[model samples]
Target chain A: MAKIELRGVVKRFGENTVCDGIDLDVSEGEMVCLIGSSGAGKSTLLRCINLLEPIEDGAIFLDGQDISVPGLDPQAVRARIGMVFQSFNLFPHKSALENALLAPRRVRGQSRADILPEVEALFARFGLADRMHNYPDQLSGGQQQRVAIVRALAMRPEVMLFDEITSALDPQLVGEVLDVLLTLKSEGITMVMATHEMGFAREAADKVCFLKDGRIIEEGPAAKLFDHPQHAETQAFLARALK
Target chain B: MPHQQTAGPTRRQIFEARQRRKSLVIASASTITVVVALIVLVPLAPGWSKVQQSFFNGAVLAKSFPKLLDAFMINVMIFAWSAPAIAVLGLLIALARDAKSPALFPLRIFGAAFTDIFRGVPVILTVYLIGFGIPGLGLPRPWNSPYIWGSLALVLTYSAYVAEIFRSGIDSVHKSQRAAALSLGLSERQVMQDVVLPQAVRNVVPAQMNMLIALQKDVSLLSFIGPVEIFRQAGVFKSLMANFTPYVGAAIIFLIVTIPATRYADYLMARQMRERS
Candidate 1:
């Protein structure tokens, strides 16, 4: 069974339909990369899977349970499907460790003492042990983004979603954040990401899905999709994206 | 070639020092001239002694100080009582105004109407309506006390303004913060209390402090409703002595209280800006 499944998912903002009847499936431990032009709804699709955007129609299934039904708790679904955004939204008032500790302490009803050991380990694992006390404003863009990822990981989510997470980093800093993703992948975490990093997607993704006008135009194994173009839209998108 | 180190100041450094000295001299000289002019002009004005006797008499000021202080304590008490109520009420109204749930549409409208009506009406009128109007209704003992009704009026008026400040502060927080918090599995209420309000409250501290200073002064308006605060005490002395020195004394007391508060607000704003930059 797929770890996460979306069948006929649709999202609209007022008169505009952003995610038009999308269907995708990610089996356990698979890294599916969504790639497209700026308005291709890749980010929207990733958000829908996390239940951040309520789908206008269709069902999202996580671990064979339908999560998109009306009145189902998005908060519960979101806890299982963690999301990291492009603009590293760490709470400025909180230090790095506090940001990482918030969800577990609140959502899981764990005391600070109970969660601290595990949170500290996650910080140490992410190379942020010394910087754990620093506030978001005190950290570098790269460090802040890494902290954001760790914050999501602290929830121990089953399926992780990344919405162009590295697009906002400096050229020199992007490598550090991507390296964190690589580490998470090695741990067998199920992941879906919308990315502009063609080179990273080609090298790191298990499956690459090309999207256009709110629909996935072509998808296959990473090497096959990146090296061999199957559709005219995919070819055009790649030509411009690679440039 | 060996670089030579000079014991004396460099030429550029000497020039900058001279520029600084010149500005200081000019500033002091101008300030002294203004002080001298005021001194010379003030006593020369017609009826200056009578004016002094009526408004600046040291003896009357001394006589009035203890009584006025006692009355001013009432104002302080009203302020101390109203501040927490205003803060909590304001934040609740602001959250209501920002609420997105369809179930809360009536509350949103109510919040909107509250801020608009209270902000539009002059505070003195609200004080009158509550302090006088409530008593005329003859509901109960506690409701009839000018202290209760007057403080209630100020709280109602100030909370509206503070709520607007809070709303703007909450709005100023980037939309991405909300998305980030919600995406972390936090319920909407948790997201607001944990993620949004902390940032919003920090952002508006300077504005909040300014409102608080305004509140300190507005508490004097309670005197009009017969609470016998600082302004009302000044009125009593003015009529009894047939002189205005007590009123001037009251004005000075208010300045003494509010000036430091204003300075503190400025300091907080400057520090917040420095931290952000």
Candidate 2:
């Protein structure tokens, strides 16, 4: 069974449907990238899997159990699947270290003493050791996004979601954040991300799903998907996206 | 000027400095004129001396000063006790207003009703209603004491204003922040206590400081229900001495407290704005 599975998931905002009968799978340690134009429901799809947006019709399953049932606690499911946002969303009032330490201590019921050394090590591993003492406002865009990633990792979640994490960074700063993702992939975390970085998606994604208007137009292994056009919509999106 | 060896004071700088001096002289002259006119013209009024004697009697002021200070301490005590209650209750009300759960709809309703009723009705009327109405129930001992009931009134009314201020502060926090916290698996309560309130409260400190200044003055409204704070004490002195100077003294005392607080609040506001920008 896939590690995270969505079966005909549907999401709507008022009159507009953002996720139209979506189906996807992320097996253990697989990196699946969702690539699409802006407002193509890529972010909303990721948000739904994280239970940030309640789906109108569909079941989300984790480890063969339906996780999207309305009464199931989102917090319990969320603790197992971490998500990073387009905006770093680091608490401005807290130091990077505190931001990383907060969720594990509060949600996972770990004492700060037990969580600190490991979280500090995660910061160091991400090349954020010196910057961890600074608040989010004090950090550069790349550094803040890295801290946000570390904050998600601190929960030690089984599955991780990235919602256009590098899209907010400057062009020059984008590489560092993408590099962090490569490291996470190599370390074998089950990861799914909605991304605008076509180069990174082509190079690093195990699976690439091309989405348009809330539906996946085409999906396959990253190499095949990028090297050959399987669908007209995918071909058109890639032409403009690559150009 | 362009060929000068040293850039010692450009011509424009010299002109600007001279203009600055000219404006300063004019400002000083105008201020002095206003001051001299007030000094000269005030006593020239037909009833000026009698008006001054009634409102500004130095003897009455001196006699009432110590006692007024004593009564003002009551105001301070009421303020000190009520301020904490207002803050805690106001925060709870704010959180209630922010309730997102369908089951918590009543709490949201209660929060909305509370702020509307207390903020809409005149504060003095609320004071009279609570201060007199509650005690009129004839509760035994301290419960019926106006000190207790009167401060309760202030807490209720000020808490409504404070709750609205707090709600604004909470609203100022971006929705994304809450999403970020919740995405971390934090329970709603944890998200609020840990993530949202800290930023919200910090954002509104200057506004709350203004509330504090208002509260300090409004504590004297308790005097109507018979707490004998500064306002009531002044009334006693006015009746006894048949002079209004005590009222003038009371105003001075209030200015002494509030003006410094007002300045400090402005300082905090400026520093916060600078930091945010």
Candidate 3:
């Protein structure tokens, strides 16, 4: 069974359908990238899978259990599927270490003493150990974005969602954040990201799905999709994107 | 030899130096003109001596100082007790006003109404109503004490204003911060307590301090309800001495207490602005 399954997921904002009848599957340990122009509902689809945006219709399944059944606790679903945003929304008041420790300590009911070693390891692994005590404002945009990713990882989520996480970063700094995703992929963590980074998606993604106007136009293995997009819309999008 | 380098002011440097010197001259000229005007106008005014004697008599000021200080202690005590109470009350009301749950609609309305009524009514009237009206009920000893009632009245009125300030601060936090917190599996209440409130409190520190300074001055209104605070004591001395010096003395004491607080608030505001930029 796929790690996550979205069947006929439809998300609407009033008259606008942001994710219309989306169907997709992310296999365990696979890295899937969603590529599309702005307002094509890439972000909304990822959010719906995490239950951050409730789908108006259809079901989302995690490891064979349907999670999109209106009454299921979204907080519980969110804990299982962590998300990092485009704008590195690190808590400005908290130090980087504290931001990483917050969810594990509070939601997981782990003591600071119990979680410290693990959190420290994450920071050290991410090359942020030296800057752990620095507040969000003290860090550069790339460093802050890395900390945000570390914060999501601290939840020990089954699947991670990245919503244009590097879009707000400077061109030079985007590499460092993309490098963290590569490291995560090597660890065999499942990831689904919405991105405008065509090169990174082509190089790193196991599969790439092209979306346009709230629908998936084409999807294939990353190499196949990037090398020869089957659909006209995907071809046009890549033409504009690669340009 | 290299081309001769003249170390004295270059042409551009000379022009800049001339501009600086001209600004200095203008500054000093303005300062001296203001001082000369004050010097020439003050002693030439009518009733100057009578005004001085009645308002600035050294002997009367000295005699009134100790008594006024003692009375001012009451104002300090009221402020000390009520400021924290007002803060807690205001925060609760602000949270209620900002609550999104359907069940909390009534509480939201109540919070809105409380702020509306208290902010619209003159604080003096609230003091009069609570301070005297509560005593008129012939309640227990604690309820009848003017200190208790006066402080209660002050807290009630000020919490309304402070709650609005807090609400604005809470609203100013970017929506993305809330999304980030919620996406981390924090419940709504935890999101507010851990994420939203801390940022809101930090954002409004200067505004809150300004309210505190205003609260410090508003304690004087308690004098109208017979609490014998600084202003009331000053009034009594004015009646007894048939001179206005006691009132002036009270004004000076207020300035002595509030000016430092005002300056500290200004400094904090400046620091906050600098940090944001």
DockQ each: 0.81, 0.80, 0.82
List model 2 lDDT by residue over B130-243, tens digit each. 999998997999788999888888898989999999999988989899999999999999988999999999999999999999999988888888888999999999999999
Across A1-243, the per-residue lDDT of candidate 3 in tens digits comes to 999998998999999999989899999999999999999999999878877788899899999999999878889888888899999999999999999898998888899999999989999999999999999989999999999999999999989999999999999999999999999999999999999999999999999999999999899999999989899888888888998
Report clash pairs, candidate 3.
none
lDDT of 3 at A194: 97
The CA lDDT of each predicted structure is 0.92, 0.93, 0.93
Q: Regarding lDDT, does 1 or 2 come out ahead? A: 2
lDDT of 1 at A198: 95
Which lDDT value does model 3 have at A70?
88
What are the clash counts of all predictions, listed in order? Answer: 0, 0, 0
Best by TM-score: 3
RMSD of each: 2.7, 2.5, 2.1
Residue B234's lDDT within candidate 3 is 93
lDDT per residue as tens, model 1, B219-254: 998888788899999999999999999999898899
Give residue A76's lDDT in candidate 2 (0 to 100): 90
Residue range B8-44, candidate 3, lDDT tens digits: 9898999999999999999999999999998888868
